[model samples]
Target: MVMNKALLAAVALATTMIIMMARPSVQESVYITNHLTKRVLIVHCRSTDTDLGAHAVAVGASFHWNFRENIFGGTFFWCKLAVEDKRIYFLAYDEYVETFGTWFVCDDGVYGTPASRPAFLKAAWTRP
Candidate 1:
C-alpha cells in the first residue's frame, strides 16, 4: 500500500507539471509616460465598442496597463491625451501580434505631437 501511494503521488506531480508547462502564457502590458515639464496629461484608453475610462498622469509620471486579446482575435486601444485644455489622440492596434508588452508616450514640447513607441525594457513577465 505504501509503494502504491508513492507511485500515485509521483504520477500526480508529473501530470501537474506537464499541464502547467503546456498552458499558454498571458503576458501583455502597456506603459504610458507623461514627459511634459508642467502640464498634466489626462489619458483616455478604450476599445472600439467599450470605454475603459480615463487616467490622469502628472508630469514625469507613467501609467501601466495589462490587457488580453479580445474575443475577435485582435486588440485595439485608442488613447486621447488632454494637455493644457488641448486634446491629442493616438491609436495602438494589434492583430497578428500576440501582445504589445510595453509602450512609451512622451511629450517633446511639440504641440499636438506626443512621441509614442515601444519601450526598451523586456517583455512582460508571465503568470500561471
Candidate 2:
C-alpha cells in the first residue's frame, strides 16, 4: 500500500507538469500590413531590449514578429513607418495593459488597427 501511494503521487506530479508544459499558447506576436496606395513602406521597430531593424515592405505586403512578453511585466514595442517623406509612429505591443496594439495599418501613414482606437502620431516630412 505504501509503494502504491508513492507511485500514484509521482504520477500525479508528472501529469501536472505535463499539463503546464502543454499550455495551448503563451507566445504573442505583432503583424504590420502595408496599405499604401503605390509606395513601399519603410518599417523599423524596437523595444526596450531589442531593435527589429529596418525593412522595406512592399505596397501590399506585411512584416511581423513573435515574442514572449517580459516575465516581470512592462514589455513594450514601438514602430516607425515611412512612405516617401511621410511618417508615423505607433506602439506594437504593451504588456502592462491594452497600452498598445499588435495589428497595424500602414496607409499614407502608420496607425494602429481600427479596433485599437488609439490616438495617433503622424508626421509630415520635410528637409530638417
lDDT of 2 by residue, 1-128 (tens): 25788899999999887876665446887888777787788889999989999999887788998888665457888888777766667667777655444444545345554353654634333322
RMSD of each: 11.5, 6.8
Clashing pairs in 1: none
User: Could you tell me which 10 consecutive residues in candidate 1 have the lowest summed lDDT?
Assistant: 119-128
Best by lDDT: 2
Supply every candidate's count of residue pairs whose N, Cα or C atoms clash at under 3 angstroms. 0, 0
Per-residue lDDT tens digits for candidate 1, residues 5-37, read: 889999999988787666555655666777667
lDDT of 1: 0.60
lDDT of candidate model 2 versus the reference: 0.70
Q: By TM-score, how accurate is candidate 1?
A: 0.56
